[model samples]
Target: MSIFQIKQKTSGAVLWTGSAHDEKTALDAMAREAGYADYASLPDQIRAGGVQAAKLDLIS
Candidate 1:
């Protein structure tokens, strides 16, 4: 699995993080959690950034 960071496009806030087999799956899941209509429209609301290994502590 790979870790992905989903950030708000306007605020650059880290909104969600998780591990998935692929990036698309991760983004889609995060988008849904953020209340977007669909993954296709996620890019407008959030920015998908670098993929990392799952960490124990993400917020600091």
Candidate 2:
């Protein structure tokens, strides 16, 4: 286990902090931040529904 911190790029404030075994765990936090998707739901949506793509492409 190791320490992982996720911070907002512009604000420079720590947004989330926890311990995980590897990078895969860290990405889970990122996915949650993007839209609050849980582990199984996040990748599933990304693989088929393009949740991330649609989020980024949102006009407003």
Candidate 3:
């Protein structure tokens, strides 16, 4: 799994930091952490442009 950093797209606030196999998985994880039943159930702000996930490069 790769490390991902999830953040609020608008304000750019850090929401979650963890590992997932891909971007889709990371978004799903974010939805879960935000208390949504699933990614599809997440609010439009989140699903559309409220949330963002980016892969991180860890320093050795």
- Evaluate all candidate structures by whole-model CA lDDT and list the values in order: 0.61, 0.51, 0.84
All-Cα superposition RMSD per candidate: 5.6, 12.0, 1.6
Instruction: Report the number of backbone clashes for model 1.
Output: 0
**Tens digits of lDDT, candidate 3, 11-57:** 89998899999988988887798798777888775556677789999
**lDDT tens string, model 1, 1-60?**
666776655566676788767767776777688687657765632345532323334465
Candidate 2 global lDDT: 0.51
What ranges in model 2 sit over 4 Å off?
Answer: 30-35, 38-60
By lDDT: ranked, best first = 3, 1, 2
**Candidate 3: TM-score?**
0.80
Candidate 1 vs candidate 2: the TM-score winner is 1
**CA deviation > 4 Å runs, candidate 3:** none
Q: How accurate locally is residue 10 in candidate 2, as Cα lDDT from 0 to 100?
A: 46
> Which residue pairs collide, candidate 2?
none
TM-score of each: 0.51, 0.45, 0.80
Model 3: residue 36 alpha-carbon error in angstroms: 1.6
The residue pairs found clashing in candidate 1 are none
TM-score of model 2 (CA atoms): 0.45
